[model samples]
Target: MRPRKPALRPGKPMVRRGVPVGSPFRLLLLGASFALTGYAGVRLLADDWFAVAVWFVGAALLHDLVLLPLYAVADRSVVRGLDATGHRDRALYVRVPAALSGLLLLVWFPLISGRVERRYRLGTGLSPDGFLARWLLITAVLFGAAALLLALRLRRATKQRPPATH
Candidate 1:
């Protein structure tokens, strides 16, 4: 039997035209493209993609294998360290990434080299200093500028605030 089509009636609700793509087909196409891109990226990057991939994989492995415990231990250590009779800074965690990334960039200054030759490094994924270190350093410098601007605004706000009532 042939499929029946919806009838168009002028007075009743207007019949909708068929979509160029239905949700399922679009989703399948999207998933296939995603897979294709990943495959191409792996092929093009070959050994170098290994570093980023391995970093992510190592992060997962470490998180599963070691970091969870380490995190718990560190969290305990931090709670113990605040020796605060009661004073605690709520924004500390928010600032930690920006702060540590800056220190790391400084420490790994050599890795921040943007020389054209560094393009070769991407394919090999092997950086004497490591991709994370370099990317973090670059990101630190760029985003840290934004962080610094925030700090400056905070400083200015503090200076501008009215003195506490006596």
Candidate 2:
């Protein structure tokens, strides 16, 4: 007598466990954004915490409407430059600047405000000199810190990824 091996199915759907990587992240992100918008709308309707509500809206607009476009342009320009010239270290020219800009916005605004009171110039709602200097100093410090972090990260990454064949 011959023993039969386990019968194999010709077609079977592979069962996957846990949340699919991208769908859950996308859902979570969208859900959080919706919640934030809902809260903001509720605040606006109530009109009790109007100033804070307005500021939140302004921040969101600044990021989504203004900052995003600027970054997209900058990213395209940097990538074009890298591609055109065939630069060896592409990330240095792109990610470093972006990271520094992010850090500057995150840290500089708060830190620099403590050093000097924001003075409004006559007539104009916003002036370049005060805004530029504060941001410039912040960005410079941020750039230096970002560069250091980048070097460390690059070193770590290099250690982890095996060398590729030509």
Candidate 3:
């Protein structure tokens, strides 16, 4: 079903008719989410909160100060390299898989690095020895799929072009 356009006030900007600009429902949902987060934080703080607070602050600072610059530099390098090769369109294919793999590595660093091997085994009754291999396999699959998709897009683009006149 199509949305109905609502009449706008003389000075007001245009918006979809059925949806109000600055939706009250979105505001309500945002307020609800904040309230729930605050409630959870309070409950969590009731027991040994200092460490949790420290962790939260430290993670934010580390990501901002360290990881962000590191990744930004890496992305710039990728872009520069692709541009030099005259294949900038292929950058997204590389970037998407790399970003996904990086995220997976970041989230599972402890298991992947075997730093928490004992704790992991105690918690899950399984070895973390295979994490590296699994991560590698996942990274390989992501890149392979991305390459396939890039090839398909290139093929489609070529096919959509009209023939050149002699």
User: lDDT tens string, model 1, 1-166?
Assistant: 7659655332333324764333555567788999998888778668787787788679899878785686566655555564353323423543465446655655655556544336547766665455456676666675666667768876887888888821
Query: CA lDDT of each candidate?
Result: 0.61, 0.66, 0.87
**Model 1 spans with C-alpha error above 4 angstroms:** 1-65, 75-87, 93-133, 142-150
lDDT of 1: 0.61
Candidate numbers sorted by lDDT from highest down: 3, 2, 1
For candidate 3, give the lDDT: 0.87
Model 1's C-alpha root-mean-square deviation from the true structure amounts to 13.3
> How are the candidates ranked when ordered by TM-score, highest leading?
3, 2, 1
Q: Write the per-residue lDDT of candidate 2 for residues 109-153, one digit (tens) a residue.
A: 644454433443343555535655767776677667776786887
The TM-score measured for candidate 3 stands at: 0.61
Global fold similarity of model 2 (TM-score): 0.39
* CA lDDT, candidate 3, residue 40: 93
Tens digit of lDDT per residue, candidate 3, span 1-166? 5658755543354455766566556667888999999999899787779998988898999999999999999998999999999987788898999999999999999889899999889999997799999999999999999999988997888888877821
Between the candidate structures 1 and 2, which one is better when assessed by TM-score? 2
Clashing pairs in 3: 5-17, 6-17
Stretch of 10 with least lDDT, candidate 1? 7-16
